[model samples]
Target: MASPKRPIRIAGCSGAATDRRDAMRALAANCPNDPIDVIIGDWMSEANMTSRAASKTDNVGEAYEPTFLEALEPALPHIAKHGIKIAVNAGASDTELLHSVVTKMVASKGLKLKVAWISGDEVLPAVREAQKANASTFENIRTGEVLNSWKFEPIYAQAYLGGLGIASAFLRGADIVVCGRVSDASPVIGAAYWWHNWQRSNLDELANAFVAGHLIECSNYVCGGNFTGFKALETKGWENIGYPIAEISSSGGVVITKNKNSGGEVSVQTCSSQLLYEIQGPWYFNSDVTAILDELWFEQLSTDRVALRGVKSDLPPPTTKIGITAKGGYQAEMHWFLCGLDIDAKARMMETQIRLLLRPHAHRFTKLAFTKNGSAPDDPTNQNAATVDFRVFAQAPKEEDLMPQRFLRPCIDPIMQGYPGATPHLDWRQALPKPVYEYYVTLLPQADVQHKVHLASGETFAIPPPPQTKTYPAQQPCQAVTRGPADGGKWGRTVTGPLGWIVHARSGDKGSNCNVGFWVRHREEWDWLRTLLSVEKVQELLADEYAGKKIDRFELPNLHAVHFLLHDHLDRGVSCSSTYDFLGKNVAEFLRARHVQLPVRFLDRGRL
Candidate 1:
């Protein structure tokens, strides 16, 4: 029998394009004592993809993320000295350009690093061709709306690639692998696959690495960033929050930890928070393998170390997510403050006046909204505290329609006739029209993507689609588990307060949809939580945002969590969303702040 291979440690240095730039250097500096074999960085997201597409359309900047270069320059020496492999999907739309630049940087530094890049993620030509042949191929994944029904023309499209291309680059002796539009966890999956010489048949091991990759893909997220129990890190301080490292054994066991003596934490709760982030349902799908998250478990091994286990898997999905970007329109906003008494009445009067003024050219506007944020205190301490903000938001197909004269004039016309203490914030830039892009997310067949890897040895090879694939139902079949009751069972004594008193939550966006995952620290609480929080309950608690909107709910018993997906919740995502919580990061907090009946037994345990 073959000897068991040793475990490999992979560190995540970045979560997004805008994450802290010094994380790479920080992780590299600690590698002398605490060695890591590979460093993976995830730098793409729906929001940044829209921005990069627009930048490319207007020839204002490179389509790729420049921050990766900024972060890599400082850590190049340490990375070369330690001989650590690096993989990142920061290439965005221009992998070749980024590869060229990085190669030049390596040569300038006199380092012997061999850099390679993977491409074929850009599928604009294919998407356009499909649109001409059969538009149904571009059906929106969430809404089921066909692409022909969309108002704007898609200028750019990129399919989510798997990690096999990265693995191919590694096998070809490349020290650094740069990719474009690979799945967020692709870097980690590719690293693990290369380290263990995993084959396509190693479904469970790949799934283990997939989940581990998801957990640490966001860098400090598994190390206490975006955690609900942030107060727990008070002594350690949040300023220098540590990045996460995934230690994956040859047997498919995984342990999550951070740098020695670093700030923040790596507990089970922190791992659970990252696990539930931005997920759609119990089955976490990827191009290479589908992870069964319902049975996954996390255990605290020691301080700053948590073990993740029980993750199961099946064959890869036949299709992968693809995002197409188009110019939605131009948008502008105006803000007015309503102070002291009669806040609602003042807001109503201003809305009436603005609506009357805008009624003339309403047909030209695609979207118009009058929103009020906060309420004035009955008896306040200061003027600032007594003020509530009222906003007038407008979107139009043409920039001229959202210009200061067209959009802002109507808002300003009502000011003199407004209620007492109604004051305009008076920021001209806020009312000036700015271009916005709409991101349409759908699935593209894996076979349609021409996945290819360009090696440092001047050879290019195509990566075929996964040989084994499965087609799952649109909705995951319900599990056979049973719960207590919808009302959370009869606890004799109960108290009314915020749901957050005993619950910890994390929320994020998936295109225009928002997913909020809520979990408890104890098993007893999970019983009550699963029974109490229902689809109807969520609609009631978030009536303003979720009322009349479609919501999908699922339970992850192993993680002691319940998740909710709010469809069309963010007004078509960040670039065009008008809501204050545009990214949906605050949806969990919003639900937590809602008052609910809580059992005294759970409350007595103290707030999370």
Candidate 2:
């Protein structure tokens, strides 16, 4: 039986640009502590993206958007030390571009290059492609109409490349990795399984890594910063914030924690709060499986760690595939703040005054406003001071020019007409207009993404070659009489992993989700592999394997594929959900679980 206990470990790097020296200082801070296996640094920000793009620091050549390189520069050297492999998506427009700089840096320092570049994810063009693929079923997520019918073009289009490509790169020997436009959660996932060279089809393994990714994806949240209601921390010594880490196992378990001696509480509530933050929906995707949420559960580990498990796969749900944000058109506003004895009266006065002021301006305003949030219980018993503010605007072709000075007439009259002393309030101003772009993330089919890891600048190095290739296990090609539906006649192929080669045969309709996929296994381990399938060797696969699941199986004559419903295997059943979070998976245990006993003798290839 699996132990209920979990590990206490957390990992992260301080890459925030409060100061350049802070990177090294953050690095030095980690130096004194016992080392954890992983270090996650979250250095990208959407706000930073806009700001960097404005400064041309992102250097996309169009003089816009922040480049991954600019942001990573301050943090790279500190990462390189301690020999911790770094994962970051600072590649900006060019995924390949950052590798050159890294390779050069390694060469300059006489350090081995452990760099992997993951790519094939720029989704801007995909909007059109997705629109075309979906038959215009996708509207800009907000707008009721189809996007293809419109003339508006986005400034940038990029997909949230999950961790796969980068993880694959780590297998290629990258000490420092860079990515572009990958969702923030992906790097942590990439780090967990990439170095180990995990099989892509290991759903549970993928689930664990994906969960780990989610925890550290948001920097301080997993640490003490976002975790509220915790007991006293040495706030005086809390100048540096703790970064999160995960001690993951191969079977898909995650233990979340932070640096030791770091002041913060890690508990179920804190962990739960982090899990639910900012998620617009129940699903989050990694490269291999789209994890289902309903299968996930979490429990606190030690003081600083929390464990998660029971993650499973699920079908992508039906929803609008396009993202839409508001267009910043011309508009109008009023700005005022009130303070007086009766906070309620002060607020009411401000409200009535603004309403009266906007009587005529309302027609001219595109979006007029007075929002009362934050303060609750308007007629408060506290009798505390209260202040109300108002901002209204007049629409125009351009937001900046909307209403100009001509709209100030009403604002200027507060001195003589309203309150005698309030007449001085006429010297107020309107709220500034700013563009509010819409944001959205869609579930594009896996087929839409074509991943590639192009290895270049291959100068031979003094670094010891990983292991003897002779002992490296080779995958045995399935001597199958057939492979179904793959346009290519290539029925059998050998893929490499940390242990050795796995020869996999292609098949179709593996599940009833109306989709097709492939499975692979080690060539020499056919006996073991055969036992895993519903094929001839296993007698008949059990429905209980699906945990009380059911589904129809079909074989497509055109494809020569035998497809069966996994039942609840990964959400083939209508009752299951999509979305899997990580809690515990020891890097070792997760991999070992897959190496089950079988009739055939297993072989070891090389040291990972």
Regions of candidate 1 where Cα sits further than 4 Å from its true position: 1-4, 478-490
Clashes of each: 0, 45
Candidate 1, 390-509: lDDT as tens digits: 999989999988877678898888777889976898786889999899999888888889999998878999999999899998876442233555444566588899999999999999
Supply the global lDDT for candidate 2.
Answer: 0.45
Best by lDDT: 1
How well does candidate 1 score on lDDT at residue 198?
87
TM-score, candidate number 2: 0.61
